[model samples]
Target: MPVTIPEIDYEAVFQSNPSAILLLTREFDIAAANRSYERMTGAVGAEIIGRNLYEVFPGGADPKKAPGPARVRASLERVLATGRRDTVGLQRYDVELPDRPGVFEPRYWSVINAPVFDTDGRVVMILHRVMEVTAFLTQLRQAHDHGITATPAEVEAMEAEYYTRVRELQQANEQLRTAHALEREIAAALRESVERQQRFVSDASHDLRSPLTGLQTRLEFALQDASDDPQQTIRSALKDAERLTEIVADLLELARLDAATPVSTEKVDLAGFVTEELGRRVSRVPVSLDLARGVIVDASPVRLARLLGNLLANAERHAFHRIEITVAADEDTAILQVADDGPGVPAADRDQIFERFHRLDEARRSDPGGTGLGLPIAREIARAHGGRLLLTDREGGACFVLRLPRSVSTGGDSG
Candidate 1:
């Protein structure tokens, strides 16, 4: 006797799948959502089905304060534009508690978004899938509270990456401070010099205290735990030391800038210079360049390169899909603009962005490696070379505009 096989229910399969999933319309309205998604978000399917994605779980009062929604929106837009899948790795997007109206609960998610193409090859819907990783991240946070630790091999890799450069550069800081003491002393006789010096000392002291305190705490922990792995303690100490070295190095660079160190100037082709800089950089986000030839600037090649690097680094910290760079020139000024598609700077904080040791909360949350001095350093370099760097207004993300005096003698070939 032959048995009849039942037809599989596609909707049943979609709804029963253990992973949290949602189907969104082209306009980002929730068309359908799975039970797992409902469970994960603590919302009923009825409440979210017809609402827009952002509306369903609004990113707090100040949208800028909550980067999760912006990132999600960006990823979805990318999928719609490219007709491909995009993955957002480990995002800290908090979810609103269903019981408590305005209060949000901390949540971490690993998200993947894919486009559902129609017969005409247009994206009709987006398949949004998310895995909640809050538990895993919470565990890691708890571990961090105890002490920083890494494997022996990891420590070796970090040392190879950070220690060599630090060792070679660390001595220069002390030497510069000692040799330039008299110069600083003479300058301190100026009107605002005393206040400025005191502020610098205070800022430097505060920044240095963090790593020093961490190092001391880790050593004390090692002393307390007789059974603690010596290698673990050493790794932790090395991590803090590396952080200290980085701070010191940045401080030294700022000191050199403050002292008005003289550097050699040359006729550089702006377009070609940017092209070379792009080649040396490795970025996760795509970069688009628009280079106009014959744009020349009289600049110190090394210092100008550093300024460009800092701008690129700042863009990388916030950029979502792409970073756009353009080089052009007017009759008297050479212009270079770097723009990103990430969230733009808030109006109130625009000028303060270049202040030393000032970092936006989002920037600090996203990038732990930054010294909060990149923009300030870039501005200083620009000023030193008789140029100016400004965070100009852009639609989607932030745009950094660099304008330098065009060189009268344009002798260099395109490069």
Candidate 2:
């Protein structure tokens, strides 16, 4: 016969071995042990397996213990004396189950004890096949003693971090107060100083215009004979003079808008305002209207009118002969939508359209797009009235939507 060695799965063989195998001396001190024997003692097989059981579980072996080591050992001794396997009650078995995460709660179990026979057929091995109630029995702590020990030295670090944040916030608040006080002082001084120069600024540019016009005429005539290409000189001179005149006009308009306080608070009908402005501005475009009525907004009438005019004018300048103006008013808000039937604004370029000095239509760039201030001025007016004008979306051409609060907060009126 051919000789062959049996293959052994060493890991599985140890795990499924029926008993807690322990090599203990006549004095019940462990010398050599298998995996199960270490578990029954609650000691690792390598360490306590070579040590005395009495020394290892001194307090653990008290019979007074409901499921104590002595009680467990007493039952095993009965099986050894008889050389017959015997069972322990559920009370003792339930106390000794293995543990792992997310496993079930332990219930009750029956344990069997026996002795392993050696080569001489003498009982030389102790075997404890302890049953499990459920594998999850060992998860929680058995019994724990706890007391809070507080010493002042341990708390110093936490106290310092709390105080540091308090100081930082205090410093930031102090700096804000200082800056606010300085701003108020400077604003008061500016008002007083400007009062002295009020008349000079109001009339100074108009006063200079007479001399500038005369000088411009003289320069134009002098340059007429200064070069043979006199037409070029004349055109340049005209352009500069026109630019100066436009600047003066802008300054005068800005001064007026800033210097005047709001004169009256009235419920100007936005639908009527839009209708009238569209008539004046959208002459070239075919306009579709969904005009909403009874939407009274709180604002300066002149400023409001200017805002609508600019929105309508912008739509006309960019559209392909057709535009839709939709006015939606509810109890809370009024949404004015101006949609053009031209190629809509590209998604990437929509944000740039409302920026100052931005003109999306290249063909109208030569007209200077009314100084590139129409949309910005419209936004300013909308903000002053506690409303906002926004360009919503442009599919092919664009859709501009203006959202406004339905009513102004006044001192007495509830609505």
Candidate 3:
């Protein structure tokens, strides 16, 4: 007769293993632990399972033992990164006493961290094995003191080696922290960029709806032969189409500015530039100019011209009889003001007027051709040039002021 042995239960073997054992996820969360581990740490299975490994065994305040946790973390990280086994010959990791709150018991450990690989040879989890060596180390120290088995020099050498390893682990831990901080910053910046893109899309869709709907309605009526004046209907449809085009163009310009593209700049004579720009465009409202000499600005000529054009167009729309343009300079600033003797902006609407696609009730009633983007575009140009545009209080009508950083004077009389 042949004797037979029953098949081994591997789970039971792991649970009953003589050494302390913990199974951890790639993220260092405790997936499971054996009974020996529970006995060694003086913690229950339910308390540590599904928690972070470090959270279960945090670093103690003792300066001598502080590096123990860092060493363990570094070893685990190395095992994960290399998919190979790593051994920490000695460590003084302290565990909290189960019965005593905030009290820790000094413990010495010999640790082995190994990869738990799946069928595809990918490391799925870490198998952390530890042996408590406090008694062995204690015995060796006692023997060294009493001239027994070990010498004083041997014990000193061992301690020096342990501290050396701790220093290396501490350095690696600091590097890991730096890398994590950089990752967080990059993630935050990406999130903000995505949010800005979302807002831009939302604003574009909202403002485009009105003109699109009007164009669709007019075309649908014209196609149905419901119009008494077909030619007039066609002209009105063309006008709506033109307005849609302008809105789209303005939106694109804003998008370009939002992308933070660098602007080209050169020194510009403020008074001369204003005179040249005003000469190109004739305003319906009578215009007066008060030009001051030696006002220079570092600016992009095309963009500055657009800013001035927008201000003039806005003034022409609202001015009842007269518009005044002024150019002057102070110690560090070049100032330009465009004032209109029209009904001044309401106190509540002054700031809102510079928001994209915002228009006042009076503006809608006065100028149907306005796209409501002029003031916003002007303000953006001003900001892009390292300047600001603001509505200042005036006795009558609205006063739009642009202030830019003044450049070194290339002195000349006003052109």
Candidate 4:
């Protein structure tokens, strides 16, 4: 006795298969696409069921030249004509990413084109099978380029070795992330530095050009006017030359500070230092000093004196009636503050006050003789000694606070 077997459900099998599959009619129009095909191509079965294959994947042909599409068409024609299966080893078929407008991401596939037959042995459809092998091909190419030759057993071993090195790979990936972050930070810092240098150059050029141009014009006028007073023209040119010399000197000092030139340190009493420096300045502004007894600091005396001179000069220019200097020390730090009874600095300009060649617009309008580097030089000196000079809030005046580390030993000469 012979047993009868039940008929297989071919359509159900095609729909449920894990591999991406598409069925096209004899004219190469899409007849049916499974779930896997929809996922792979970002296509819907209902939308593309009757559309031409080339219309759905326009990338099958190169847009610029017709050869790409012609080649693909020729391959399909040959498969249909011979009623045989054709294998495409590798093809790049870029697809638009879902929800990403106008972005076609790259994809690679190994594909098979086989003819499907009807009951009368006529070619009824084309069965397309696609397997994405992008990662495998990429690794294979990289291994070949690196001169790695492996047998089947060796390949298996190499795969196991790759698994073992996963932790190391993860660590390397983390290091790469850290390195990228550091690179971005460095790039930003470099850009900021470049902008600062450009601003400095522009300011310096303008300042230097003013004096030089004036001097040149004075000399040229003196040469052209025979009857003009030689002595007066000579004096005017000398004054312009003097202004240029002062600007050049300030530039040199700033350059030295930027080069991190070391200064000799000595313990000196802050009270005596401030008093002596203030007395040296010939200013009509009535000065007041509040001295803290036995307050000493380790610092370069010359640099310290220069710092005080700049601060006093600035205060003398702006102060209306009086200037006050105070020296005090805590266990760890010494504070020296200078306050004036004049209009205080604008809030917006406070942050940029210590930048090189930065001058207040009002100051430039009133006092054209300033070199614009005084506050910057003073701040650089303070920083060299591990301290800071900052503008503190004050009512009706500008107040500058200079903080420095107190000397470890208070027993030093009160020079």
Top candidate (TM-score): 4
Query: Which lDDT values do the candidates have, in the order given?
Result: 0.84, 0.60, 0.85, 0.80
Candidate 3 vs. true structure, TM-score? 0.55
Residue pairs with colliding backbones in model 1 are none
Task: Order the numbered candidates by lDDT, best leading.
Answer: 3, 1, 4, 2
227-329 per-residue lDDT for model 2 (tens digits): 5466665666676577566555544544454565455657766778777776665267788888767676676777777777777777777777788888777
Query: Could you estimate the TM-score for every candidate?
Result: 0.52, 0.42, 0.55, 0.59
**Tens digit of lDDT per residue, candidate 3, span 222-252?**
8888645889888988888998898898887
State the lDDT of candidate 4 residue by residue for 227-341, as single tens digits: 8899999899899999999888888887788789887899878998988887677886898888886778899999999899899888888899999999987667888998998
In terms of lDDT, the best-performing candidate is: 3
Error of 2 at 187 (Å): 15
Instruction: List the pairs of residues colliding in candidate 3.
Output: none
Q: List model 1 lDDT by residue over 40-76, tens digit each.
A: 8887898778999888877675668886788789889
Please state every model's RMSD to the true fold in angstroms.
29.2, 24.2, 13.2, 19.6
Candidate 3 yields a Cα-based lDDT of: 0.85
Which pairs of residues collide in candidate 4? Answer: none
Q: Which run of 10 residues does model 2 get worst, by summed lDDT?
A: 136-145
Deviation of model 2 at 225, angstroms: 6.2
* TM-score head-to-head 1 vs 4, winner: 4
Using TM-score as the yardstick, the better of models 3 and 4 is: 4
